[model samples]
Target chain A: MARRPLQEINAGSMADIAFLLLIFFLVTTTMDQDIGILRQLPPPVPEDLETPPVKKRNVYEVLVNSRNQLLVEGERMDIADLKEGAKMFYTNPNKDPDLPILTRQTRGAVEENITLLQQALVKDPKNKQLETDLKKWKGKLSAIELIGEYDELPTSALISLQNDRGTKYAMYISVQNELSAAINELRNELAQDKFGVAYSELNPSVAEDKPKIKAIRAVYPQRISEAEPKDISGN
Target chain B: MSKFTRKGKKGTPAVSTASLPDIIFMLLFFFMVVTVMRQDDPKVSISKPNATETEKLEKKSLVDYINVGTPIDTRFGTEPKIQLDDAFAEVVDIQFWIKENRDRRDEAEKPLITTSLKVDSDVKMGVVTDIKQELREAQALKINYSVNKGSALDNN
Candidate 1:
């Protein structure tokens, strides 16, 4: 019996199969680009823990009620202006000398202290006191520089975000985002002014420029303190 | 000049069908890599609020989603509720879920895990705050408040 040669499989249908699969995926697939505001929740406090008293001047209080109305530092404000308001509060550029000065001294004193520490360190390389003092002075110098540019030192400014229990989630998130944007804007401005680079371009993965970014972050750390949700009806 | 005239005479020679499959296959692979299947079908309708200062959640694997919105089905009632995974859950369930998710991850990766709260704009802050408190107790501090992109001026 003569064996019939195997028939050649049709290659023409391969393209059709590929097209079918492609279309199936195209119909079912959804690209996930998850974008949102990243935040770090404060660690839970003990019920017995007493709330520390914050100076009225230092605390930049932002309140959102059930109606999504904003009460910023006791005055009504629009959400559109929250960023600028937050920036102004954080930088406190026109810092009244009459206001109780926190530990921060004049910018000249910080700079002079830093220079003296550097000279002392050079004279006594093994002096741990000199090393620590130099570090402290350097930190103050950055804070001073940040204050000089933004008006208020970032470290000294505390943002307290409070919302009513009945406040819409949308309003709460909007306020939080605005506060973050203010801090980010300040950082970006500092990065641009000092390093001549955009804040988005400052990658921690890059070794050489990491310190510059770290210094900026140290100066304008995100200091949002979320207060417990209050009952609007009760108050 | 003579070679060019001869090539033009063929009039685009049936535009080779040989690479058709390869082209289609390339697209298929591209979609396969980029496509992320919806992990949980939301039981409640969620219309997220918009914000200008949004950051993209970088690692998908390290993120867990907590959805909060009013139930779409009438049987569940008109009031808003929290949906953990596939089922309706209370605020207290957040700690349990966080622990379960944390346990599933490798010890080294546990710290990087973030809980993305996809809360509906219409939901009240009371529920969200409760959820946040539970998360804090569970030591899942990192959170991403999921929102759509919108201009700051739109708040008005």
Candidate 2:
């Protein structure tokens, strides 16, 4: 407001200020991450398989009370050999390899898994929840029973087990993470083969332990089930 | 008009930024303290598994919550009647919720449904899975599991 000649604002100073602001923002900006499943969003669900997507109808309810009593198919699973039986749920002798992975575990693997579980319970007897956890783990094991050849099987069959809401979330989440891992494994293994089920991959230390190829994906109700060719094509 | 001052050369534009770090730090601290963290706490206990891929998110739209009280009115009634957070309920309810959410969005926008499952840390696996299965069955556009800071603070 001074009654004197005004000096023009230098354009050079403005350019310098702009560059500084640009650098500041560039240095501090965070990357855009995918917090949850980031899909194209109109919908991510693909069409259901020509074969009806396995519904929740086949879920076998396994209940474990706070006391750790295991129930499978509505009967008490012998705590001593529950794993052995679960393995048998997945593996049937000399039938079509065309069978589902949800029903193809071996009697021996089931036994070994049960023994390991029993050992865990025996080692950690103070915690009553361990036994309950061991019971639910069986279904996950059945779905992800990895074979000697590192081949994997289809575990698309949804298995629902019920535990008390009062139970620790850790126990449930671990079981779920295990199931997701198994399902992920099953999908990766089958992605390469035809007719789906393949041997479970064993660890590279032993070729039998290497991960098998997986090929199955999950489908739930409520979402439109249009066949997205990609889901069916890659396999 | 001809007065000379020793500080005449101090009028550099860069001088303004001398205190920029402190000013910015103070403002950031002010917001950090004054602004209540818009956290999505179900006020229920939730146990989240450790995953390297997990990330913290800012405001997410109406994600579902589960507060595990004594399970009552649950499908697993024979086990015991303890109040359950929505996590242990049937798949159908979750599907219904998702469809409702999807339908409520703006017509021109791509229906982006972000179904979040926040179960108490001690909730049952069967219950959690059932909820997830329901969301999946509902054909959720995208689903994410939320972890509580209290649980996450443990390892650190």
Candidate 3:
């Protein structure tokens, strides 16, 4: 027996329902953002505050050549080291949340260090003498080294620059300048955070520490080639 | 014709709206579970760039992050890996985290509607763009790469 024509179901309410549902989802569904760790950089107070060490503190020497063989400190560090340092940086330790001013002050010093490093490296034609000096310390050619002695090193942030074969000395400066600018800006922004503590006395102010800020350099590979140890002597 | 019997479709069942109410109810339920039930992953707070115009948002432990900072040279120089906090993450690591977190939320039927990226203030524009490019490709393009808006003292 043929089934009676399925009653032509009229579900006009589907439209109202759909529209209502759309509005409901659109309205009630909170598409709010998940904020990351960010706090304001408060103004500096006079007293030396008890500060927490930077939570993400790992110093890495990032050396980039024309060939893009990256280096850490004096040694040729592969990509793996980069990850470790970055992660270690994150794990260094969270600053005590109270000392916002301290965070700002220290960050300023790092900013200067980064800025100076950028300036030194990005200069056109590059200062050959300085690159040479930096390299002499690196170890003369024949050594694909990865590190330098860590005893009592300068506290400044350093970014050494060297170029690959056939690269213009100008390229060395260009890279240095670009990298420096980026890093300094970041430093400044970060320093303004609310989480840091000053472990030391506020004897030296950020303003006073300007010229004494950390140092950054642009070392040419040809120059660094000299610093490369005699593979046998160093290894 | 028999008096044109009513075709207004059962007077809309007085249920107001269907389908969507069910869908929204389901979604609301899903998020409520996420915000309350799911084991919140450990969160590492980067020194986020503060913004004066910014509002206090509900902090999410499940943030999709792109670490735009100096990657560590773990073995000094032998192996360079990008660490998402202490986790030795690769570019693929970022990709995996992005995908994994998003997927985890998605599986629970709560697709991540947004993301946060921590780029060091000194990070380059190109680097930020590169990360953004990756996020876009991953379809987690809706993101908030934190930046220092202005000193809080700016207004005062």
Of the candidates shown, which would achieve the greatest lDDT relative to the real structure? 1
DockQ of every candidate: 0.61, 0.15, 0.04
Query: lDDT per residue, candidate 3, A104-128, as tens digits?
Result: 2233443455456556767733788
C-alpha RMSD over true interface residues, each candidate? 1.6, 9.9, 16.0
Evaluated against the true structure, the overall lDDT of model 2 is: 0.43
Off by over 4 Å in 3: A1-235, B1-48, B71-81, B106-109, B147-149, B152-156
Ranking the candidates on lDDT from highest down gives 1, 2, 3
lDDT of 3 at A93: 34
The sequence of per-residue lDDT tens digits that candidate 1 reaches over residues B38-96 is 67888999988988888889889899999999898879998999998899999878889
Chain B TM-score in each of the candidates: 0.85, 0.48, 0.50
How do the residues A1-235 of candidate 2 rate in per-residue lDDT, one tens digit apiece? 7698888764445545545654555545444332421111233344563555563324434454543345655778643343333333333234433333334345466567778888988989877787876764454354355322222234453344455533345543333333333344434445435334333322336543333321122211112121221111111
Give the Cα lDDT of each candidate: 0.82, 0.43, 0.39
Q: Output the better candidate (1/2) by DockQ.
A: 1
Chain A superposition TM-score per model: 0.73, 0.32, 0.23
CAPRI docking class of candidate 1 = medium
- For residues B75-119, write the lDDT of model 3, one tens digit per residue: 434222234544645454555667667666645534434566665
